[model samples]
Target: MKALAALALFLLALHPLSSSAQVAPAYHARAEQLLPLLGKDGGEKDFFSDLFLTAVPVNQWRALTADLRRQYGEPQSLGSVRQNGPTAGQVEVRYRRATVGFTLVIAPEAPNRVIGLQIVGAKQADDSLIKVIDDFEALPGQTAFAIARLTDGGPQWIATRAPDRQMATGSSFKLYVLAELARAVEAGERRWSDVIPLSHKSFSGRLLAYPDRAPMTLHSLATTMIAESDNSAADTLLLALGRENVDATLSRAGHAEADAALPLLTTAEAFALKMPANASLRQSYARASIAQRRAMLRDHAARLDAKAVDIGTVAETPASIDSAEWFASPKDEVALLDWLRRHGGEALPIMAVNPGIAPADAARWKYLGYKGGSEPGVMAMNFLAQAKDGSWYAVTGSWNNPAARLDEPRFVALMTRALNLLAETSR
Candidate 1:
């Protein structure tokens, strides 16, 4: 008899007894009733919690407690009840600071507690936290594209198209050109201040129209080309950098698909590639001479497998065919940004293209860099911003919606929203 009694006591102690155990019958019954509501994997706990905590009125806590006790015996403890704010849901429970608590949210027709009890804080039942939950639940399912929230490094939204989809780049390809130029200057192969004369042949349309035709320094031309989207400066820099050097630099940068032998293309040639058959090729060539037009068309024909004459008067340079399809992924773009951040030392001229930064924020953000590209129906912007917190993020967004031809404005809006979202979440 003594041995049996000792064995029973040992078994009882192994399971232990607590306030929660006192209500074991009711809890188990409630758990069974609520199990179905909890869903197959029991993953809807948080969702149900948010619904219940937000749905119930704070003033009814005492009355609800009384009803609960009358129907299912007294609860072990009501825990802590705290108010967060206007936006977030309020909580009322009997709990101590630092103590774990379980929450069970019950809904009508679901005669069981939908959520299993879980640990919570007395102080965390605040309005702000509730608002966060509400906001998350309220997000729309469809968006323009997959966009990364700059603040928290989280992908905040995904657009209809897969985020990984690649598109033709258009003017954004200029970044590659600028990158090559920067690499040359860094390698001591070229100097920032080195001036290379512009040939009359290189002057057509805009370049031909510029008053300052004297030998322009490489630094001036490079900056103007990238920052202003200056086609003439881009062509000149391309010639200066040489096709071989640019191709080698691109290869080194892991742009294996890029052709080094391709000629520097002009905006006119790029536009002409998409021109309709009915359009006048020579008239569309703008100021390009017959020889320049022939050369441009020849290059375009070679790259796109179409007759150069068909492409018309656009002075087709090597830069013309450098579309977005040069094959870059978001991850690749981010990696390139990281490399530039590390090795693009002392080349402030090339790195100064942020279009949307304010002076004050620029000072606070410390390093604000941006690259944007736009063509008829394509728009893209790549950003590298280092915040005051010593953390940095690299973001790139490319939109290719033929129906929506507003590339620059759209890109600016998307980039701004992403940056702002990042700043908000970082805190």
Candidate 2:
């Protein structure tokens, strides 16, 4: 699910083109139904999308909507709804003092389907920003966190509980993957245009959904891996650049416990390790020699049935998530982002493809790049932005609660505020 987290949102608002056709009554009803679900968990909002235009799976949809939940808390009522083009439109949904808009891309034909929905002009004030961060720190099960602004040479603090402690960071580890690939490109070992074959299909990615033998350029893989946080693309690029190379890159990027996630697991390998039913299999992989890790990963992934590993189902038991998952601290992420600033300019354009921050906040900066990852109990949001003033900043946050399912919307709200706090610094 980390791959799909923050995957929605077009960044650019979908302004309606000229349309003489009336907005369908059913579509209006669907938009009306969608209003109440805006700020809360969006279980019912799933019904708005037309199957023809929006073919995202249910689990993936939830993961993408996590961004909206963070940005838009709850809709009090719709101010108005306007038809955009013949098929899509924008709805003004008010949330407390905030009046956020969302573009709904409706289908051209039957059912007046909703193919897309994304928060528009989402913004927050300086006051509640502190409150949300404070409340999140006081959360009973949340872990140590950090929300600091990394300017030219300062981290004007925003929030922290135990900012130094490391926790499982899920797919946020792909930052190192990108760094290693960049290093490889600099060394002339890989090219952005090099076409590579897809090796394995994994949950939570567009690449896996593509037909077998589809070749993707190294540049395409790098961008999409950050853009959509594509898991298969991450794993594919990881293997191509050599796992050890990525490990070294993490170390270079200042990962405090670089070896903690030693021989960092791919989405395929990590997916297999999460099964409580495969306890023995997990132990064997852990105990296996370093030389045998790849073979072990392939052998295990090949045997695991994809249908059996529903993220919604297996989330109940994080058998190996805590101990076996990727680990990072806010301090470590800040260091990584700093390293990215010095060495990862190539990554900025790709990361900017998904403006995971509030649209209003994002508008304050010349560039904004984000990567967030989550499972059931763990979540991480890391940002690297360059303000219009030509200064850079990084805000990294993680919440780990192995005890129960996380309050994901709450987590997203707090993290979005962290970004808002950074946006304020840009002024």
> Judged by lDDT, which candidate is best?
2
Would you estimate the TM-scores of all the predictions?
0.50, 0.71
- Model 1, 1-427: lDDT tens digits are 1211001111111112233333434343443333332222333333343434444333332343343334234233343433221111212333222121233322222222333232221122232323332332233321123333333343333222334444445555566677787787788887778888763222223455666556888777767766676667766666568745654555565443333213334444454444444244424343455355546566544443223325333323222222312335454455555556655664443656644433322343556676666654555667666766766666676655444344243245335545544554443
Which runs of model 2 end up more than 4 angstroms from their true locations? 1-129, 151-158, 281-319
Root-mean-square deviation of Cα positions for candidate 2 versus the true structure, in angstroms: 7.4
* Model 2 weakest lDDT span, ten residues long: 3-12
Q: Global lDDT of each model? A: 0.45, 0.69
**lDDT score, residue 45, model 2?**
41
Residue 17's lDDT within candidate 2 is: 32
Pick by TM-score: which candidate is best?
A: 2
